[model samples]
Target: MAKKKSTRRPRARPEAADAPPESANVAQDFANLHVWQIQAFRDILLVAAIVALVWAGYALRAVTVPLLVALLLAYLFEPLIARLSQHPRVSRPTAILGLLGTVGVVVVLLIALTLPTMVRQTTQLVTDLRDERVLARLVELQEAATSQVDRLLGVFSKDETTPDGPETPVTGESDEESAPDGPIPGEPEAGTTGPPVPNGPAVMTEEQVRDLIDERIARERARVAEAEEGGAWWFTPGTGRVARGGWQAISRMIGAVVGIGLMTFLIPFYFFFFSLWYHDVLEFFGRLIPESKRPRTLELLQKMDFVVAGFVRGRIVISLIMGLMLAIGWMICGVPSALVVGLVVGIFCAVPYLGVVGIPLAVGLLVLEQLGLPEAERMGWLWVVLWPTVVFVIVQLIEGWVLTPLIAGKATNLDPVTVLVAVLAGGSVLGIYGMLLAIPLAACGKILLTEVVLPKVNAWTRGEARDPLPLN
Candidate 1:
């Protein structure tokens, strides 16, 4: 064999030689695929790609959220940059830098002015919530509620035919006979600080009330203790382990803050670049679409942009204005944590009536704060309730009549009911971001339904073969 090392290699088996290569067979099969089959495969691939992208976005949200926020800011600020760049002296880059610098300075001023006070108030509020003062107030309120309820029941128990008499709790003779010779069931013990408890037919015994409060307190304390001793890096201060864990936690916290700051700082750069080359980016994406589809696609995107821009930009301005109003109003009314509460309410107000919840929250906080104070220093519940209510009412009136009409306009054009439902649905599915986006998304959906889906459905019903319409 070596002597005659054949110039040619041995041939394959006849069957193997006759058969086409696997790749060629695959190609032939692919070529033979029906049009519908090819379309179906493409659709499946598109769906798979979309699903993969969504999964990746969810998995990487910690990174994606900040980027998305930056993108949103860029989108919001692009028009300003464009307008500024139209001036003879201002180049696009210079416009971006100037605008970003102005925004940065304003933000710094606001933070410097409000952040320390907000932090101090917010910390004090949290501490008050965690302590016994709030719990004691809650108990007193519960007792008062129980007493009122008991009185109401007793009035109903009395004969209706009898003329109205001095209101008194109806303790049946059996209850009085069976009662022990200790202190009355509802009377305050000596040295008690709260309102004198109603003496008569009580709904819940003092022991029962005390036990309920104690149980809740115990559970809360245990939870706080568990959190303090959690498997987190930090632990209660004592040993080397504690020091090491504390350092680790501190370092991690610092790293997180730095990461956030860096991300925030980079947003301006992102905005600058995005604005500078916005047209280039648009053109690049436009090239991907078929020539026939490009105009329609661009039109649809423009419409979406209009809707999103109107809602988002208008809502943000409105929210900021409303928040400022609320903060000032609350501060003027002597509400504790006014800045924090006002800011929260303003943010909530971005979603229409969602801010109504802040009424109860404000009322509760005022009640708690007042109840914690010395009796002489405490504002009556009437004023405590009225101040916040009046502030909210005035702010709402201003917003309904002025700010909304002026700033937000009729961008979404959705009914209040629809807006509420959409917001609730979105919040349930995707938390706060969902709530914020829900209105615009619903509006967009409505447009799609009206412009695209309905027409197709009507055509189908009439047995007409309408060409698949582009979104626009």
Candidate 2:
């Protein structure tokens, strides 16, 4: 009876006996894990991502452009939509239509104002290029540059030959033989050597210098002509009456115009409906998830929405403010095409860090162009020395101390260095469109990863059975 009681007392439940061993094995495996498999998996994912990105770039160019345009337009007008939504009498569709109409009118007015000037300027530029006088002037410039360079080289070469010494003549046999002997030809007597022949340096004759310059000019002109003749096809216009090349260029231009117009036309339509129904769509889709994970999914979506909305709204505000400031500044400086330059700056400002670098550069170039060739040459050095430095300093100061803080705020939580790198990488991958989308996409990705992924990983590390809720 005592032996039977002891055998029963030593027995343990199967679940209880297996639990600790299972967990211990899991811990041991985690501790002794080889990361090569994980790393390989990551590498495979990276390669797949890259391939997908490249394929999407080529395959979805049309859809992508319009979608991006619509997204941006929607973001810009979201505030208006929200405000209009609160109106007692205005329907959402009506409000959206009103905003779209306003945007369209504004855009149309801008194009009307700009197109005439742009066309005139472009035609004038082409005409100027074809003008024989302009070509001659360009040739003259090349000659002048070449001559100046040659003169600089000659001066340096001559300086190299002149030994560093006091103004003393070396006693050479030629000098000794040619020495004056009682009023020799072209020489005064020792007491009166005609101001000692102005002993600082010997000047080359004007005729000889001119001849050297002419030779250098001729060589430069030949080089320039040769290069021009062999230049890219774009630089050379059609040679015959067969307008194939001309038609091709025109067709390309038209295609670009049409593409932009289509983007502009379609974006508002998509944005309006998309914004109106986005919440419903999201909720509907979210319901498919298991009840256990729905809360986390909703939280992730909320964070993503907040991040995207904040960034987009912030960029629009910043771009508008920058455009206003540029217009005002250009007008104050009496710069030509102030409105156009301001508009350009505003458009570019929609981009992040590139705007910071590009706006001042564009303004400086406009200032230089307005100064004209002769004025630019005469006072160009002053502008080259002063204008860019002043403008860039001012722009950076405004961006750092005022605009960026006011618009983007601490919500982005992104460093300037990070923003710049993202923009550059995006630009390299997808050109201008990529650059435009990069920062916002990066911000969204940051929000998703930090609020969604990290919490799960943390819970897993703690041997938790369930994932933790994402941070708001």
Instruction: Give the TM-score (vs. native) of candidate 2.
Output: 0.63
lDDT of 1: 0.84
TM-score per candidate, chains pooled: 0.72, 0.63
- lDDT (Cα, 0-100) at 320 in candidate 2: 75
lDDT tens per residue, model 2, 148-242: 89999999999998889877766798787987555544445566636433435667997899899889989976766776888843443344444
Q: Pick the candidate with the highest TM-score.
A: 1
lDDT of 2 at 349: 77
Candidate 1, residues 312-415: lDDT per residue as tens digits?
99888888888889889888877789899999899988887778887888888888877778889988768988999899999999988898788878877788
lDDT of 2: 0.71
Model 2 bad stretches (over 4 Å): 1-60, 112-238, 257-261, 288-290, 327-338, 356-380, 448-472
